[model samples]
Target: MADNSSGGESTFTVLLALGANAAIGVLKLVAGLLTGSAAMLAEAAHSAADTTTEGLLLAALRRSGKRADRQHPFGYGKERFFWALIAAVSIFVSGGAFAIIEGIRTVLGEEAEQTLAWVAYAVLGVSFLLEGTSWLQAVRQVRKESAAEDLGFFAWLRRTDDPTVVTVCCEDSAALIGLLLAFAGVGLHQLTGSGIWDGIASLLIGVLLTFVAYVLGRINKGLLIGRQADVRLVRSIRQRLDGHEGISGVVDLLTMMVGTDQVLLCARLDFDDALGAADVERLCVRLENELREEFSDLDEIFLEPVPREDPDIRARVLERYGENPLSTRSAPGGATRSETPSGE
Candidate 1:
């Protein structure tokens, strides 16, 4: 279960981030206007960008939830990756780039005094608290999902298949850092009566955002291209097939994660020697039904019967499964028999 965030939990997190950002963005703009602070203005833009990204993630969640169709046999799950990529780009451009430009413009052109500086400080406190609330929810989801596999939290996050969850979490984290920078920048400007501190803070915030966006973009690109399904699910499916009385040995197995909760599986296996055509057909149906029951996330499981000596198919099987079927036997060039299953 790479992304157990397949249900309402992820949407709730995105909505929370959206709400927090929307409120914080307005406050930041007001504070910036009142204080004439460049850092506050950049913070407002960053918040506004985060709100837009959250909306995109929500749309991805909704659109990717639809069932498989004739137009898309694999279902629309990849839409989550698509929208997450867009959100990452938006953060880099709308948030990071704009903030840098604003910072540069302010440093070059402004000699303005920061009036009502206390108001900006007050807004920073409120924004930090709201952003923290959103961040906690995202972390809770991440921790819950990671603990089930005994995997380190950061390890799970890197390969998480649910883009919506990752997007919201990353955005909120960057928002928190940006808020701190804004606060420090404003404070320094007030103390030294120098606008350079504000401009410098804005630049640092932009760099932080760019780094987050770059990491997110690369990860989402991998998802769009298709990463392997969870290792747990892969091993589980293999073990389940081996346990089936009708199956002799698995010849080939392929899995694609077409959605957060939906996985498409195709397996080529050796059935019992005595099974007739009708028996094999019935076994396929039975196996598919059993797998669906055991692993509800299996959107489709197509079991194909193939002989152990299939040359071309064996090559593909070796390529995908990364094991030599012949060598897996007691004798050379003999087929491996799986009367019992084992783990890696």
Candidate 2:
């Protein structure tokens, strides 16, 4: 889950990438036209794709932030995943496809003489600087958010619910590498007087963009389908439930990420047989309030009182967690202890 600060950071990152890509795209177009470098043209397409992606991401952020209404009881959080998925498709279609086609045509057709090569070089250098600035901003945001969650950078990225920052980071990183590939293509063409290197460079850039698109697409797909909340958060919730005085044991716990910073949690617990109906009702209300206060990301919660030793429930838990599904014990302080559940 993300915080308000992370959301702001994501917006800033997207805006920066948007500005840089827009400017870089125009420059690359001009340079490609003047130089007749296939790689330069491919890079121009890359920037165009990135610029369009940024616009879609802006829409994602805005639409996904809408408040829940009758039409969408869970809010519009999944809109972000949908838009991000579209952006990935845009990258592959507009950028990778164009670059690949251009590369093939240039390689097979009559080799055109590279002209005004210096212009391509100048454009690539400027584009690198702008893309690098955006990349750095994205890195800073990811680092801060990952640190807040007490997870390694890559681990956090893989599990993060926020898609805006991840998309920006990946696009800018690809842009920078594409610029380097363009530079190499131009330089080699000028030295060897062969457009083959330029074509090869374009092919490589296409492949790179395709790979990035695939990775992001897979991520957004899983997210849109629904994924579990952070493992640490799940563990913390289970520990709290196990330690509660009224709860004899936890039968089952379930969680899902509903939005960028929202989670839905459901817990089945075994209450003490001594507690009356009124007491159990009060305890349930108290637990809901307390859990929400403790973990701000818990947007929705449901607690069900159940018998811990029910055969049906025990079988379900066992099916999910193997033989040791009930990893419960008593500590020296008379506190209930439980390990991280396998369901998470």
Candidate 3:
């Protein structure tokens, strides 16, 4: 199961980003028209794309939470990754591509006077405020989750392996940066009467968005393709299995990430011969129970036992029979071979 609190918090943050960006996108579109600033237009496109992505992300989160079925034994966790990839693509196509085109047009001497530079400034300020709020919320969630995992915020973000949160955070941060760039461009164009500065800013914002999209895409791809879990976690599980009673040794272990925090474990244990079949069964059960108790994220556990006495079973039985061979006592009548043994 996922961490409900964290998931909910992340979902809330995404919704906030969506709401904020939707409003900001409208304002930016108006400002872009009023000022004819390429940078403002690019910012508007970026926010619009972000809004769409957030909506998709929320849908993905819901779909990914569906229970496993016969057709999908591993559940629908990858749905989140799939939607995150879609979000990245949205950013690239809607935001990056638009920005690039607008920038190229502005660079090609398409000069439009900033009829409403003040309007752009006002919209950019509002955009900054909204994006900042969303970004702060995302950062807070990351900090809280990372602290729980004993990792720094950025480290946790990188290591989390959850595409939704990572993508959302990246988008929010990029939006914030885009807002700053848009403001700078508009300000420079107003100050120097040079639309080229605005064009350059648009180009830079496009580059930033594209880079962010690529990063998000890579992360989601890894999750979709089933990346391996942390080695430390696997080692910890192996140590626990090795230390269990009735387990002679841990021969092998395997772990796989089934979801954000869920894992499947397979372990091979060597058991002493003196341990009975019933004992082996009980040990396996207990070990699985303990593992579940210790690691709530461990979803399934398979334990195989190697018996210690299979090689000497017959020899040991024969030796025991020889040592206690029937008590030979002298019978009242002269001992016959059949009567030689009193007990058998």
Candidate 4:
């Protein structure tokens, strides 16, 4: 057992991003209307979509924090993932799809006056600064999560379970890049006296949004279905178990995310040869306490004591349960001695 809890860092981050996007959306809408800039209009629509998705993400964080009940023993952690997936889908349909269609329409239309193109550029400059601010916040969180480890940003993004964290990061990065494209498109159109360059910028923004939406959807879907913690976290847990005096070593350790900030840990431990049943019980309690203190994200823990080097019994257990018996797939009758705690 461990202290089951979640955090508010994700909510705070989403709130900041939402405010930025809301302001950006308003600015783009006004600029697009005044100048008839295709890129500006597409960016406005994209900002609108982002605002809606962030609202959904905030709702998810709220729902997933609910306490567990009889019918749902695992609590509502998956709700966060469900909303996250919806957010990704919305990004594709509302932002990416809409942008592509707008780009095509603009590409085929007649040239507009370059008189107000300057307004679009001004809006883009401001939007880029705001988006960059949001992105910096996301990157800071990632670095803190990795314990100051200098892993690549993409690698960390794939490994993290916090949907809001990655969503905000990806969205902000896309927005900054989009602002650049818009600027280039407007600049080229102003210099060349053609609308083709502006349309091309809209096209590029749409393609970029589509790709980012795809990545977010795939990652969130995995979390929604139940994904294990990263390999690095698992190895770290193993090290902790190995260092404990009463335990010989960890035979196997497995983990799965039940919520954005909650994880369930299950492990088979090999007790020291001289420890008795009472000693084993006390050791289990002590180790669990240690783990809870060390890993605030852990919500639950199941420790199964067994001999680390017992080949005969290990083979039999493996044959019956396949992998990770804690997942509810077990031998006939749905209960077995090997599945029992401490080889009882």
Which candidate gets the maximum lDDT versus the true structure? 2
Per-residue lDDT of 1-344 in model 1, one digit per residue for the tens? 55454468888999999999999999999999999888899999899889989999998988988877999988898998899999999999988997898789778885778899999989999999999999999999889887866878888888678877788888888999899999999999999999888988888888888898998999899888877777788889888886789787777677887777778898888898899999999888888888988897788788889886667876665555465343354412563532212123
lDDT of 2 by residue, 1-344 (tens): 66866777788899999999999999999999999999999999999999999999999999998999999998888899999999999999999999999999999999899999989988988999999999999999989888987888888889899988889989888988898998999999999999999999999999999999999999999888888888888888988888999887777888888788888898998898899999999999999999999999998899999876567887777677666536666733575544336454
Task: Give the root-mean-square deviation of each candidate in angstroms.
Answer: 3.1, 2.9, 14.2, 6.8
Q: State each model's CA lDDT, in order.
A: 0.84, 0.89, 0.78, 0.80
Backbone clashes in model 4: 0
Per-model TM against the reference: 0.90, 0.94, 0.84, 0.79
Point out where model 4 deviates above 4 Å.
Answer: 1-6, 109-115, 147-154, 242-249, 270-283, 305-344
After superposing candidate 1 on the true structure, give the runs of residues whose Cα lies further than 4 Å from its correct spot: 2-6, 108-110, 320-327, 331-344
Candidate achieving higher lDDT, 1 or 2: 2
lDDT per residue as tens, model 4, 127-203: 88887787788777766665444556667677777788889889988988898888988889889988888888889
Q: Candidate 1: TM-score?
A: 0.90
Error of 3 at 88 (Å): 1.6
lDDT at 268 for candidate 1? Answer: 81
lDDT of 3 by residue, 122-212 (tens): 8888888888998888888888888877888778877785777788789988988888898889999989998998998999999999999
What lDDT score is found at residue 19 in candidate 1?
Answer: 96
Candidate No. with top TM-score: 2
Q: After superposing candidate 2, which stretches have Cα over 4 Å from the reference?
A: 325-340
